[model samples]
Target: MEDPRTDGAGSARREPEAAAWGERVARFVRGRVFPRESVLDGGGPEAAEALAALRAEARAEGLWALPLPAALGGGGLSFGAYAELAEAEGASDHGPAALGSAPLLDVTMLARFGRPEVREAYLKRLVAGEVRTCYAMTEPGVPGTDPFRTATRAERHPDGGWLVTGRKWFTSGAAGADLVTVMARTSGAAGDREGLSLLLVPTGSAGFRVVRELPVLGAPGQYEIALDGVRVPADHLLGEPGEALAIAGERLQLGRTLRCLRWLGQAQRAFDLMCERAATHDGSRGPLADQQLVQAHVFDALLALRTTRPLVREAVALIASGRDARTEVGLAKVAAARMLQQVADSAIQIHGAAGLGPDTPLPALFRTGRAARILDGPDELHITAVARRVLRTYGRAG
Candidate 1:
């Protein structure tokens, strides 16, 4: 398919295709994912089976991994085009996993930097959903904000393979992953920026072990892992030695943008729930929608959602075009996270006790909202990073 930005006419043509796909994904999420959300979120053999069934159905309907590269057995939608569908696909937390888009970051990274053998080994299986992967970067007792201080190290064995040693916590999806991409220092001291590299380790490797599950806001996915001299072949190294930071930076640019899109979807759902309750639920005073305070919640939530969407879209466009997008992504990440929390809080308030209970999805939505701020490098990090980048331009001008 032609890149829409390559020509004037292609831009108009791609819009309808993306819109149509977005609608299909949205419908699937509503019909398939929403109904099974409780089971999917519960995390067990039953949840795994339900999720696998959903994946099968998604694949049968031709809705699996639309955003992934076509060569990798996906629909091969461009990032910009996929941005249109991401919101719908991410409405429920399980949407990405069910629809086969969850491994996007790992797939792309391995494809770009993996040795021919590494790609041959895992890329196709990964795209085909035959396996699962997780990323381990943050460590327990260490501030994830400062990755340069990572204490994990990978030493070269006599055979020239790598033996990795360290611990990582909050590694999402680690419990079931077939492979894990680890960040470890190959040559630098703990505080040095250079010499860090990424290595692909099979979960079944002798020394690799999952220490424990680390629940986030009561959700079951994150894990603490220990890599005690886990060995990997020389070719499993991603990019050049000391290139981990560069590669991770590129990955995060896209990851944060995708997250912003998902947060917007969640926020929109919360807003809808808030509106529905206000309109239909009649309290002692009258319909909640008739109350002035309830109206305030609706107005504020709508304003936030509207204002944050454009920021996220701008970031998506920039990243899709392969330009530097740090400033835009940071702004969108903070805004979308805050918007989700604010909107979901209002939705829960409108639902009263029912929102906090298992009867409604408000609590789950709110939990995500609360966690969004901390995950992917908290709001303060983005706020300061964007500010620093902006101020640098002024410094250059002066």
Candidate 2:
């Protein structure tokens, strides 16, 4: 059979050069990077050193960040071209970070609206992986998808600074983050979207505290933060006081697209795992591959993956072309997230007890799949958004 790494809706549609670049990234991940999973996860000093060395190696091989501009220390791939490369890089959770491209969101946003001082201080460092940043938007009470419900507040100080006060949770990578882009109300009340602002709060501030780490699936990944009058310079404001929502929308569109690509890669990984199990695991009668029931699992996973792939690419392409892609992104978000969750479930079922343990990557991939549905935005939110958009089309016709 052909190598599954180069097989997909996105890969088939990609130009030869683009597809080859993506394939090279996949091969690098599968070979040089996959073996260093332990060092990446160790979260220790030694692991840090090893990961830094690995990033240097990956960069030297022209496999670094592919989505950002080349002027910003990236591979200069457009969103359309980066879609397939993202899939290859998504084969492992550490693939993007290890390759020096994980800060795409922050770097892109900084380049667009950041103050000169702020950009000088953090932008290059972020691209170089010298610092880590987290986005704090969800609070203790608001729905994660509703920016209007944010309870965080920022009060302007007399000295051209602001005192931010609020509590945020599920702030991913906050434990070690050097900075956080906090969304807080500067002029409007709760449930008002127009007054929200994004403030670049340095983690060393007196009141910017890391309350605790919130573990998902029994592992610590996200964090809770308490901003008790955290002071930030006036220039820390991103874009403008009332413009964060629009900026956030742009960032989220790109983020969701990247996630879809990553999820596709992960689903493909699970699909391969299921196929391997079916081919090798012999039961009472014969190899699982010979049994119709096992074949059903493989077929279903492939179907889900193949179907979701095109929808995701459609969304990515729309976003790439600067078109209004809310409907497409909503559809892709719900489908790709569900696809990953379902494929991971099937792969787990095929592996039985072995899939539950750490001996395989299935367990971790399953956790990511589950989170994919709820993170960024939940499936329910996207489903409603997509349905409403479709209904609007019918309304217009009628």
Candidate 3:
């Protein structure tokens, strides 16, 4: 477990300091997070208490917010170094939040584009984990694949502010968020790409409401929300007007890459479970590991994990250097997601009835595996996008 250091050329190398930090994270995930999955996932006062205790422990152990800036009260790890530990940190669903890395994307976005007022109001608290935030970009009826078609609108008010109105669903962590970064049309029509903008909206606003929880595969977190003419102060806008798509694209590049790493971690966890079961669980003939079919499952899962890791790492290197990583990120996103799903399925199959039951983590892994394809951007979208980008190069040569 080494922290991956990047050279001047943005290539990954090994570093002892980073390795020690990465090991601390892996140990924390295994020692603390893994043991409390039931309580953390339970969703009640007890779950809240458990999570708070974990966060406090994480802070006490000096393992909190490793990827955020040192000026912002974090460990100040570069994205390159953090990418090495992300897989370990993200092995459990609660890892990022507990370790205070969950807010990296939003915190970074706000630090870069937030108005003085917005930053002064929330940035410190967000990094300190005093408050939580969620991003709202997906609309209820609009296809999330096309941001140009966003239906949410933010109209200019007489006072030079905004009146936002929209319905958004599948907004993760909205139920507990203190603030939300919403994507809305500021000028152009629904199909126009130029008018989308980012607005910072507090959940306590006059017209803000959480409609309901939209659980995925019986797991909680996602929510539907409504904004009925919510008044947002003029300075609440992120970056310039009509810059939401650009901001979101930058956010997603990192977001999707981190997600791919986490998916690989979870897939590796599932693969381990599958192997352990195969080696120990007796079958009709003998040990399941001896069976060719079970061996094939092991081989395939390992191969997927092995191949997807390098693609994800390559994307990480490109992003860490502030290069255009759209193609690399797109390829890694699809590959890692599919790898997770395939590996998790094989794990579940090896486990038989117990895998589907609540006794094992296999069920939860499988649930996330299924949803991974659709989240961020669906597999089909990534496939077409990557193919289009690749084809354009050949087109230019011709």
Task: Give lDDT for model 2.
Answer: 0.83
- Top candidate on TM-score is 1
Which stretches in model 1 have alpha-carbon errors above 4 Å? Answer: 1-16, 396-398
Candidate 3 lDDT, 175-237, residue by residue in tens: 999999999999979898699899999999999999999989899999999999999999999
TM for candidate 1 is: 0.96
Tell me the tens digit of each residue's lDDT in model 1 across 64-83.
Answer: 87776666677677778888
Each candidate's clash count: 0, 0, 1
The count of backbone overlaps in candidate 1 is 0
* Runs off by more than 4 Å, candidate 2: 1-16, 396-398
| Model 3 C-alpha lDDT versus the unseen true structure | 0.89
Better of 1 and 2 by TM-score: 1
Candidate with better lDDT, 1 vs 3? 1
Instruction: Please provide TM-scores, in order, for all candidate models, with all chains considered together.
Output: 0.96, 0.93, 0.95
Q: Which ten-residue region of model 1 has the weakest summed lDDT?
A: 1-10
- Candidate 2 Cα deviation (angstroms), residue 56: 2.1
Clashing pairs in 1: none
